[model samples]
Target chain A: MAYSDKVLDHYNNPRNVGSLDKADQNVGTGIVGAPECGDVMKLQIKVNDATGIIDEAKFKTFGCGSAIASSSLATEWLKGKTVDEAMAIKNTDIVNELSLPPVKIHCSVLAEDAIKAAINDYKAKGSTRKPAAGVEA
Target chain B: MRYYEALGLEPRLALDAGDLQKRFYDRSRQWHPDRFSTRPAAEQRTALEMTALINDAFRTLRDPAARAEYVLSENGLEASAQRGKDVPADLLEEVLELNMALEEADGAQVARSLGQFESMLAGVDGQLAGLFAAWDAAPSAGRLEPVRAALNRRKYIANLVRDARKTLETARET
Candidate 1:
């Protein structure tokens, strides 16, 4: 079947297609896969430490056009959004945007899941950091 | 259950091929549409359905990998395309690199990568064999988790091999 125009557009011009520094405390990396299709996706978000807003997002996906498009669009929507707002981005919206068929719906699901995983990683790191010992100048 | 019952056998992963063939032949003969011509229309329809089911069951059960997947789904541990999540991290990284190679490599490079992927697939299969034995011995949901995970790994490796071969073929055709 022919892909939607949006899907093709994103596939040909995938935005933010790279990896962030995963070891950075301010960056959260999400890695996910679909073993049945041999697809893998890695999404990362860099969040400002004090403001809780995402400053940048990047993704690397190993799959079909729909998967690449899905993650590419995911990163595009992530930048400049608050973590809470990003969490609200649903797979169905992506499906509608890309006009993904029922078969490709899982691709969108993978994208949404990657977003959540990245946010969780970011939160986990914050929680694990040592608290401030005292007031500073 | 339907397939095994149709063939007068138990649900088993290690079915004897000769026995399965004999059973399939016998059932096909009994349910053949020609034999039901003289019967009522309803009987003919039922016979047609049964014949179709028997054929499908035999085809699925004959393949070892398909049979394993069938057994897993039957036991509520379905190995669906949608259920692929939480793959081990190191393997995910390897898959990403392999995908990049497949995109940029020529026929010779693809062949080399294909060999490496095939070996990885074989290793996963060997691990699956051990897991299958463990599950067959005990047959519990807990024991099935590792088997399911192994199957996922096998599926990924198998798909990569298919992709690499396709890329090689396409390059050759050009």
Candidate 2:
């Protein structure tokens, strides 16, 4: 039942806790929930279109300390990473960094899912804005 | 299923409370340790085990939510096995928005949201009643799926209501 120091630290002072404009073409928002625990997490990333790097990340989570910490850490790792690099981020990395216990492993998975969902949303928006010019024509 | 077996009832979702109480008491008396005290040590052990199982069965089967969960687990649809993949996106969005509003809600706003959440809980419970009957009439995976989804939604809303009440109490105390 005891949380690791890292989890407590992030929990008490979660970084990048806020929201991004979902309507912005460059911003991707991911909202996910855990029915088992009644937890909801929202993670958003603003990608720098010119460089394809994530310049901003934010999260709002309503759940246990572990879930809040997981999403907080996720946003921190998300910023400054290119889209491809962000996609490679895994839940295990968050688990190791946060020292989450076995029961809290699902929190990390939720964070990873949020990251992927946000990226997918951003990519989906991009594909819609610009059609496949050469292939269709 | 074992709980149902322990109480000598079929594994069904709906049960009369009075009948269940009677069955529990009847089984408890039959397995009372006093009756087995004069018997062999093996018989005494069996009595002790039966007493525990009967108590557990009564406790679980009395609550509709817990009873549904028991049936789900027996059929390989355990709640813990669910990862929110089945949660509709619109529900998640609504939950997120409500949480955001709650963070900044004043006393009046909190009370309003509490009323809304309570009614939502009522709606979910009503849905559950219909689902339980549907499953009892004809048990099938298709029928159980909606029951599980409704249970998940109920759990989420229940948590919201609990937290909102706590927040309101704290606000009043301060």
Candidate 3:
């Protein structure tokens, strides 16, 4: 089946396609593998330490184009937001936004999951403030 | 039943594969269905069935684990299925507790727990393997299906844990 227009948009003009300084304590990085498909995704977020907001988000994905599009959309949704707000983001929304079919729905979910992993990595390392709102410093 | 019964000798399990292949080719020249395709219908059918039997026997003898399982099963020493169904209560408890933890966690928190869940999964895999071996050693067939069903449940639940982890990891992005 043909991809939805939104997925095509994200694929054609991917947002947040680069890396951030991984050494920053406030930044959490998530790298995940899809063993069944032998796919890999690297997602990163820079959270404001004091505010728990996401200042910048980026991704590097090595997989199908659907996966790449999903990551791009996810990064757009996450940037300039509080970590808590980002956490509230849903895979269903991504699917709806992309109008992904059942076969490619997993790609949207994968993107959502990559975001959560990055945030969780930050939380586990001990930043007490709940994820804040509006990522801009 | 004769190994050389091709020529009248016993088929040796330890025959080198290359030698076995050569011998099989030699026999096929005389007994192959390709040679009898234009012959009587009865002869063709017999040739087909014998060829199938020979190939089945060859494959069965080739794999060590399949051979062992076949031998034990034929001798009525197969592992009892019921032995695996009795999963320890503590393992069940652990599974339940982890499920509860994931249920209570938000997306970000659940992502944080994924690594731990992965390690837990490894342990579960080990337990399942041990149970399989133990059952194989038992003589009962009565509980085998139920035991396999329980193992399937564990596998299904493990997939859910993985799903939860994935949700936690990437929910924030979109």
Candidate 4:
């Protein structure tokens, strides 16, 4: 199948293609996979605690060109957005930007799911950590 | 179910390959187009269709993975319908780690890991066998759930193995 030029562009030069430290308290990691196609994607976001904004985003995906491009575009959109804004990002947005075909829509859905999972992970970590009571200046 | 009916067998996960082959051959002979050429046109068409179905059924049921997939589809658990929601967290982590390793590994490192990936594939196949037996012994939704999960894992590992092999081949050519 012919891939949209945008999809090929992101696939050839995927932005923010790397990893963030999963153990970091401020970093949220999302790992997801599509069983039907054996596609696996890992997207991570490092949120600025003080600004409540995502300062960095990284992703690694192993699948078809569409899957790679979806996650790559997702990371690009993720940076500079607050956690709330990131939550608003939808699969349809990715589909529209990438011009993904009907069959490849699931690739965009996977990216959306990764974003949610990462944010949830970040929130879970924040809630689990003890509050700084005595150390307050 | 048509595949099972074509082969004169019940819709079950586990099957005796030799018996299946025997049934296929017996049915193929019974419906062979050559034997129906003198019959009516409709009868000839039926013979041709039956032969085609038998051939397809044999090809699909002879392979363990294909057979399991057929059973799953028959039970309304299509592989393509599965999304990230059903994938276990640990399995995704392991697959991600393996992909990361493959990305960073040199030619020699990749070649070395090919063996590991093949062994992993074999291990998944063994797991599939056990799952198939479980479903055959006691047919239930619960029994088929693990079978689907195992098939997914098997597919992931198989893709990894294929990629690793392709990388090695490309290195050799270069």
- Chain A TM-score per model, please list them: 0.93, 0.93, 0.86, 0.94
lDDT by residue (A67-122, candidate 2, tens digit) is 99999999999999999999999999999999998999999999998999899999
**Top of the candidates by TM-score:** 2
Question: Relative to the unseen true structure, what is the Cα RMSD of model 1?
Answer: 3.0
lDDT of 4 by residue, B49-92 (tens): 99999999999999999999999998899887887979999999
What order do you get sorting by DockQ, best first?
4, 2, 1, 3
- The candidate with the higher DockQ, 1 or 2, is 2
Give the C-alpha interface root-mean-square deviation per candidate.
Answer: 2.1, 1.1, 14.6, 0.8
**DockQ winner between candidates 1 and 4:** 4
Instruction: For all candidates, state DockQ relative to the true structure.
Output: 0.61, 0.69, 0.02, 0.80
Candidate with the greatest DockQ versus the true structure: 4
> Please, what is the TM-score per model?
0.87, 0.95, 0.44, 0.93
Model 1, A1-137: lDDT tens digits are 89999999999999999988988888998888876676889999999866779999999998899999999999999999999999999999999999999989889988998999899898889865534345242
Candidate 4 DockQ category?
medium
Q: Quick one: RMSD of model 3?
A: 15.3
For residues B1-174, could you state the per-residue lDDT of candidate 2 as single tens digits?
799999999988888999999999999999999999999999999999999999999999999889999999999988778875567878889988888888799999999999999999999989999999999999999999999899888988998899889889999999
Model 3 chain A — which ten-residue stretch has the worst lDDT? A31-40
Estimate, for each residue in B1-174, the C-alpha lDDT of model 1 and write its tens digit: 787888888776666789899999999999999999999999999999999999989998877677778887887777553344567878777777788778888789899999999999889878877776777677788877787778777877888899999888888898
lDDT of 3 by residue, B1-174 (tens): 322344322433223456556656666666789989999999999888767666665566444333333443454534332221233334433443455566678876687667776766676556655555555566356534433433433543565566675677567776
Off by more than 4 A, model 4: A128-137
lDDT order, best first, reads 4, 2, 1, 3
